[model samples]
Target: MRRLRMGMIGGGPGSFIGPVHRIAAELDREIELVAGAFSSNAGRSRAAGEQYRIDPSRAYADVAALIAGETARADGVDFVTIVSPNHHHLPAARAALAAGIPVLSDKPATATLAEAQELADVVRGAALPYALTYTYSGYPLVREARARIAAGALGTIRKVVVEYPQGWLAGEASGKQAEWRVDPARAGEGGCIGDIGVHALHLAEFVTGLRVTELLADLAAVVPGRALDDDCTVLLRFENGARGVLLTSQIEIGELNGLRIRAYGDRGGLVWKQEEPNSLTLYDLDGGCSMVRAGTALLGADAAARTRTPGGHPEGYLEAFANLYRDFAALLRGEPAPLLPGIEDGLRGMAFIATAVAASRDRAGWVPLSV
Candidate 1:
């Protein structure tokens, strides 16, 4: 198959997610970084292009020019990826899709559920592939956990608990990383919940094949003077009558990026921790304990395809992130959407964020979801 041409918006100088996106798209060898708009600043966009050997002339000033220029070119980018701030995503994605270009965006679909719903219409109407990167579901073991649960290894899921904690906001962080995210105008409402808690929300549903129907939440601004939530605890009711809890925070001092999940059923339970991505611990109803290690010879093809290197070589965050890119590229190349999280998944994520925010008011009362 011919290599897919890829472009980007909002991942220019000092954007932590841009380089990560580039390297990820590069991993599958089926994608090529042919062009991009990079940043709104002309000089910065040119500089960002120079790093990838894109001629300065094609490095446009903004999304409008990027879409117009790239579309008019003979060898236009087959698709675009949006890695901009929360508020910028809807416009950028709409432009690319309107121009008949596919899109892969960072999570939280849009700044608001209304915008997300509109974008979802565009995606469905255009018959274009749109994906949201929920990094955890890209893990091989997480996929394995989903498969096991689906196959009845864990019957009648009774509970699901996911926790994502980070130390990034443990104190004030300066520079591009912390500034825009903490700024309500750029990051949208519900800081910690939208940014990280949504990740946990997506992970639980993706693995369990269950939807969170109603939630009671307690969202807090643990950071002394922060404008939005930095800690959130959500009580959940699944469509299947399963109960769940999601606890996420950005103020857990020294915890670093710790994401963990535990799902239990009448027949068994399974656990996976993001810090230790390669191992899954299982508990049977009869007290049989087993560990399913990644790269083990006995696993099925799905897990094997995702396992790179040997059993103990320590493939991590970059690889997990890349998994989303690989799947997106595959789908853009005419394959099925990667069963992980995509645009619909992103819409669900936005729903969780918006619902959590609404629930947080009235002292974090219960909110019913349309999912």
Candidate 2:
């Protein structure tokens, strides 16, 4: 099998997500990092290329130069991965697609909803394979949960509760990651909500197969002098009439990446947590509860297909993230990929952010989620 070549943007020094993308994309041995514009500074970008051990000649100063250089080569990159801050996602994706390269971008689509909307048009015009790394959806157990819900094991979903909380920003913070996330010019109008809150919202909807139609939100900047929201609570109305609550905060002291979701239906309930990615909990109407472990025989085809190990062995964050890349490889090879989040998911997530921000800012009781 031929390995697809990948070019990256923004995984410069000290970037947390950039290295993760490289590792995950190569884990299945189906992709290779061939080039990148790793940072805004020309010197730093070249240094990062050397660190990745790629040909330093392929390291460019910006997206435009990268596109020009790569597209001119017969062995150019098979796709482009955008790991920059929210603000850079649009231009990078647009440039790659226009140059006839596929795109895989990090979450929240773009800095603002308007940019996401524009990117949608660009993607459609390019008619190429574009995906968003909604990493949790790649977990084996999470796939099982989705399969069970889709199979009617959960009956009619009546309610949902999802949350993502972290304590790193509970006090004063200073770092490349923290700086870009809190800046509205880079992170958009949402802070915690745009960052982790969008993940919770996507997870709830993805597992339950429900779309959030309306929501009432309360957003706050928990830490003094912060320019964007650090905490938020949202009440949701699903298209099928299911109710939901989403809570996301960066100022919760001592907490880590505790993302969890619970959904109840007429016949039962389902639970999945990010910390414990290997197991899913299911409840029966008769007060019976069961745990479904990943790599077990009880899992559906979707879960089994993604599972890499047998029962009792754990597959974690890196593996989960790798699933997306592996499946994307299949997609580019003309194979089926039912769960890959694409431009539409990107649009919906941005709409969620915009709607939540508007509802909270305007004190609107409830607002429709429209892109």
Candidate 3:
């Protein structure tokens, strides 16, 4: 298959996610970064193009220029990747979709729920394949877990516990990344909740194939004078009467990307942790235990299809991210991308953020989480 050309919006100097997106998208040789509006600053965007070794003429000053220049060419970008901060996601995507290009964007969809809803309309109208990088859903073992739950390997899921804890924001916000994340205007209403909490929410729903119907939430800005919540605990009720607990915080000192999930059903329970991304553990009611490793025969077809290497060869964040890119590439080719997250997932995530924030702010007890 030919490489799908990709244009990037953001991920300039010192930007963490942009590099990841570039590297991941090109990993399988299915996508290539041909052009980008790497920064809002014209100089930086051009310099970034030079840094990436793409032709200087193709690097544009901003999204408008990128779209205009690229679309004018016969070999224009097949899709654009929006890796900018929360606020920029909507405008960039809107422009790309309007130009008749597909889009693969970073999660949360938009800065606010209203923006996400608007983007949804635009996506539907465009009739293009729009995907979100809900990266964890691409993990081989994560796919394995999802397949097992859906196949009734764990009979009648009763509970789900997903937690994502990071200690980077325990002190006063410092770096460029931290600055925008805590800013309400840039990152939206919920801080930790909108940031990492949405990932946990998506993972839980993706794995169990269950929707969060209602929730009672407690959100706090643990750092003094912070505008948005940095820590949160949400009590969830899934569509199938399964209870869930979602804990995500950026203020937990000593914690480093500790994302873990455990789900229990009548027959068994399964556990998977992001830090140890290779394996999944399952336990039965009578104390029988088994381990399912990535790239192993134990995994279902969905998981096996995603695994790239042998069982012992570890595949971490970038590979999992690349899976989404690969899937998006498949989607652009009119192939089925069953594991990919799209506009609906984006809506649910935005709703998760808006509803969780409102529930906590108003001290509302057990409010319905309408997506």
Candidate 4:
């Protein structure tokens, strides 16, 4: 099979997510990194291109130049990956889509809810394939959990608890990632809520297939001298009458990407953690418990299809992220791909961030989400 050519907007020197995106995109041998505007600085962009061994001519100064140069080529990139900070996601995506290129963007979709909606409208009219990298949804065990919940194994979902805590921003840290995330002008109205809480929110909705109808949130800047929130807690009311609690913190010491979710229903409950990832614990109403491991016969077709290793082996973050790229490549190849988070998910996530910010600011008890 011919690999689809890809261009990236960011992931310059010292960047975190760009390399991850590149690695994940190439993991299945279905996508190739052909071009990129890796950084804002022309020199740095060229340097990154040199590191990636991309043709010198394809290493443009910025995303606009990359889009122009790539689109003008007969062998232009088949798609564009927007790995820039929140502020750049909207423009890069808009340019790619307007140029008739497909887009795969990092999470939160855009800097704000309005931008996300605008992008969603453009995508809706374009009829082009666009996807959001809600990375956790790509996990095999996560799919297994979704399948179980959809199959009514967890009858009448009653409650959900999801938390994502990181210690990287525990103090006054200065770096590209930390700088943009804590700046409202760059990260939008939310900080921790937009960064990690959105992941928790998406995970809850993705696994349970329940939309958050209303939410009440409390956001705080835990670190001294920080402008944006470093910690937040949200109360969610699902459309199916289920209640949920979401907690996200970037200032929690010793917590390293501790994303965990648990859902309880009338018949049973399920728990999955990002740290372990390979196994899901299922609790019966009868007080019995069973552990469902990934790559096992017990997994559903969707989960099994995503699993690569056997029962005892492990698949992790990169693999889960690769699933999204792999599925997107399959779609571009005119093959049937499993459900991947699309423009709608992007809109919803942005809405969640916007509403949570509003709730926190206005002390709103329960704000109804309109996305």
In order, what lDDT does every prediction score?
Answer: 0.86, 0.92, 0.94, 0.92
lDDT of 3 at 21: 95
C-alpha positional error of residue 146 in candidate 4 after TM-score superposition, expressed in Å: 0.2
In model 2, state the lDDT of residue 33. 97
**What does candidate 3's lDDT look like per residue over 226-337, in tens digits?**
9999999999999989999999999999999999999999999999999999999999999999998888888788788878899899998999999999999989898999
**What is the lDDT for 270 in model 4?**
98
Clash total of candidate 3: 0
Stretches > 4 Å off in candidate 3: none
lDDT-wise, the better of 3 and 4 is 3
The TM-score, computed over Cα atoms with residue i paired to residue i, of candidate 3 is: 0.99
The digit string of per-residue lDDT tens for model 4 on 1-371 reads: 68899999999998899999999999989899999999999999999999888999999999889988998899999999999889998888888889999999999899999999899998998889999899999999999999999999989999999999999999876898888998989888789989998899999999999999999999988778888889999999999899999999998899999999999999999999999999999999999999999888998898998998898999999999999999999878778765799989898999999898888988989899877
Listed in order, each prediction's TM-score against the native is 0.96, 0.99, 0.99, 0.98
How displaced is residue 116 in candidate 1, in Å?
A: 0.6
Better of 3 and 4 by TM-score: 3
Cα RMSD, each candidate? 1.4, 0.8, 0.7, 1.0
lDDT of 1 at 160: 99
The TM-score ranking, best first, is: 3, 2, 4, 1
Query: Ten-residue segment with the worst summed lDDT in candidate 2?
Result: 168-177
Looking at model 4, the pairs that clash are none
